[model samples]
Target: MLMSPTNRLQRLADDSSANSLSHRLRARRFQLFEQLIGGLDRPLSIIDVGGTNRYWEQRGWAGRDDISITLVNLEAEPQVHANIQPTAGDATDLSEHADDSFDIAFSNSVIEHLFTVDNQAKMAREIQRVGRAYWVQTPNFWFPIEPHFLVPVWHWLPESTRVAILRRRGVGWAGRTPDADKALRVIQEHRLMRRSELAHLFPDAKIVGEKFGGLTKSWTALGGFPALDRVTA
Candidate 1:
């Protein structure tokens, strides 16, 4: 039998490629998800908002068993088993799926990508519509620097100064669509959400936990960025 992706990941601990960031992020997410949904055996369905097949692959492929992991993205679908289906769609509108179709819907650093305030609110509604619970996490805005990938909390910066900071992050309105830039350009606006801000989306959902990532020593150590994990409406 072929070695599993998680096992392979262990062997790749020393990988030096720059693309390794994506892999490491995915691994961290899997660990967090495993921790959250540890007890339940065979959830009826698990939808990963803006997720990839890498999720199923990393979980020894067992997590995908009986789990309808519908990867939501604007890009083309990835190659995965039937248990993993990729849909080219928007989170603001998930009307394609039946109501209560998924036991859990996961989104990591995705809500910020929404183009409009209305769209972001609609995305929350869609997630709440399809899944029994939502597992969403994003960079905390109350801190300093840009939380994009733990640059620091830039939320404290004034709009004029911060937008310039975001321009440095490849966000420009010159060629971008008004809707697409709502989120993609928020970096300059210092547009991260605090715990209260997130709570507003799902007033009924409680904040289950918060975590500060990194532990120093690592170059990209984001130990400062506060990450909130919530199970809300």
Candidate 2:
């Protein structure tokens, strides 16, 4: 059966299959993450902002005695592993965690969902304050395709045009929300970041680009880690 463009993109975004593009890219990203922290001799504590237990479990980090992972989201997720702890919190305000409380503050594809650049900056500040080291990733604004919508040039379209498109049909992760206002709200929630913006947000961090077909697909701000020349994804 032939898959539509929307369906094909949704499939590519799915992380359930080890063979999926998202999973493969994430696996490669993890390798770089491991290298950055592997030299440490002590047990590691990680506070994952807007993260899930499934992410760590898939990477075989769950239930490890040497690592403790605290998953933070708007609502606490169901507990599935002893080493993984779920907590309800806002990414923009991680006030519950003390300064340098976690060995690493990690987030993946989350900064862009904050609805505004101001909120994104708040999250970046909080992440830096709470963890001794941090790693944050977001979709690249220059990428030809809008990852969330699975639409080519969707992010480049004007506000009214994006809303109209969303009201007509289901796209990637979002279903058709006939209400114009609701569709507009959904469109406003996702704001991709450019390399310069990321660098400005985390001035202390090194900006790493995740590339596909020689074009950068996403950006990662890496802070307080040993300098590495490159990480190919």
Candidate 3:
């Protein structure tokens, strides 16, 4: 059965649109998890650090005894879902738990939220300390600062200049230093890590996959994400 050129063109257009849409949605899902934990399947021990996550409770993403979840926050456990255990703690210090505590430790845009580079490193160590493997998501520094972590890794800039620029842009103003600490509170999101940065952090840990992350626009290959695959010791 031969088709007309018009039908062929339409089919091509539809196929292109569908492929583009699927790609966009996949990237968006990663971004959403950077803000909140969702879309993961199965019942398992999931630990979220340093943010508010209510998706499992509302959506019932849990899979029974095979999966359990907890939130390690900076404050007392909130009165909420019976399944979620919110614990008062810091990401850097999880001394409260024994070795190899949880199956998956998750944090999105969290490390840059730390007050200092040292603090961020400590948080990373602790995450490695507890979980089997981690799914730590942040932004690529080359982009602009919409949520936080400063597109282009503004942390490397002179504090004065960074402040002035963000100030003019109506960010990190009001006498607040526009660092990762401020980002954690203000933007609630952040830039992803650079290639070198991720390598240094993970060190011996294998990097399974990475994706270019963004909101609604195109992201260069260099400005994508670093999704991890790990073999727990």
> Compared with the true structure, what per-residue lDDT tens digits does model 1 show for residues 97-210?
888788787786677667456666887788778876667766555544343433333446565565454444432222222443453455432245656666777765644333
C-alpha positional error of residue 119 in candidate 2 after TM-score superposition, expressed in Å: 0.3
Arranged by TM-score with the best first, the candidates are: 2, 1, 3
Residue-level lDDT tens digits of model 2 in 43-87? 899999999989998899999999999999999999999999999
| Clashing pairs in model 1, backbone N/Cα/C closer than 3 A | 144-152, 144-153, 145-152, 145-153, 145-154, 146-152, 163-188, 213-223
- The prediction achieving the highest lDDT against the true structure is 2
Q: State which candidate, 1 or 3, has the greater TM-score.
A: 1
lDDT of 3 by residue, 78-164 (tens): 746555777889888988976667767777556666655567678778777777656665544444432332234455566556545
Q: After superposition, how far is residue 56 of candidate 3 from its true place, in Å?
A: 4.1
User: Which wins on TM-score, candidate 2 or candidate 3?
Assistant: 2
> Model 2 misses residue 44 by how many Å?
0.4
Count of residue pairs whose backbone atoms collide, per candidate: 8, 0, 13
* Per-candidate alpha-carbon RMSD to the true structure: 9.6, 1.6, 11.5
Q: After best superposition, candidate 2 residue 145: deviation in angstroms?
A: 0.9
Name the lDDT value of residue 84 in candidate 2: 96
